[model samples]
Target: MDMLPVDRTNAECWQLGTDQITVLTTCAQTSGQIFAVEIRMPPGGGPPVLHRHDPSEVYYVLEGEFTFYVGGEGGVTRHRAGVGDVVPLDGGTPHTVRNESDADAVAFAVHTPGAVMEGFTRAAAVLGAPGARPTMEEVLALADAHGIEMLGPVPAQL
Candidate 1:
């Protein structure tokens, strides 16, 4: 299959929850090899729940700082990552990330063998619109459809 070059400058950005998500490379674009997205999160913003999915995710911090929570048999581990840091989340590992700094955060997230994340992100962008708070049930249903399992709420402290 021929893979065309992607110019993100023309990519559309969608508000997925509190973050701006720009799908840089979609599954269709890469023939299911990868899915890449750029996310811009406001201070104190992040995903609402810790979740696990089929695709391994790698995050490269571009600006500001973020706190990541990874769950394991020993419980959850918290770590701080700043610009230029690379954080990898293995497939089936439950984890979440947040921007706890005073400034906004920018990061690039890449999923290997790109599952349905691009579609999931697009759906989330619409369901989580301003003044439209999606219920936990709604969120879980969406996640389930994308082969993701919602674990629990994000950690209280960064």
Candidate 2:
């Protein structure tokens, strides 16, 4: 219920596939209200599948550009995001944020329920070593356990 100041130097860092995830605030730290992680993604880095989770999320782009694909009542919309762009993703909407550029990208992935990021990053750690890509079967299993529903494969964008 007090100010939880986290120093960047002391924050825990982990690797999920090619992503460098620095957990700034955790679900336990905030009493399950919010969880946030800073993600450093390389070019061509992101999930291979379009997934939907229960917690609504926000992506604040700090560096580089990302192609955001989100599904709505009509259809999927492709958004080209760059530095300082903020994207709001609703809970239960299928989406994926990908760094399709030649350079790296950095952003804060903030989730309302917090369990989404917490479960995902921890699962990635258990799945394998840093930067290890999980197979489709493994991904499916993880998603199933974590309340995530896989919609389909990530589509190609221009």
Model 1 spans > 4 angstroms off: 1-5, 155-158
Model 1 residue 79 lDDT? 90
Q: Which candidate is the best by TM-score?
A: 2
Model 2: pairs clashing at backbone N, Cα or C within 3 Å: none
lDDT of 2: 0.84
Could you say which candidate leads in lDDT?
A: 1
State how far residue 60 of model 2 sits from its true place (Å): 0.7
Worst 10 residues of 1 by lDDT: 1-10
- Give the Å error, residue 49, model 1: 1.8
Candidate 2 regions exceeding 4 Å error are 1-3, 131-134
Q: After superposition, how far is residue 36 of candidate 2 from its true place, in Å?
A: 0.4
What's model 1's lDDT at 28?
A: 77
Q: Check candidate 1 and list the clashing pairs.
A: none
lDDT of 1 by residue, 1-158 (tens): 43357676788788877788888888877788888998899998998678888889999999999889999997888899999999999899999999989999999999987857776887888888888988978988988988988888865654
Model 1: per-residue Cα lDDT at residue 27: 81
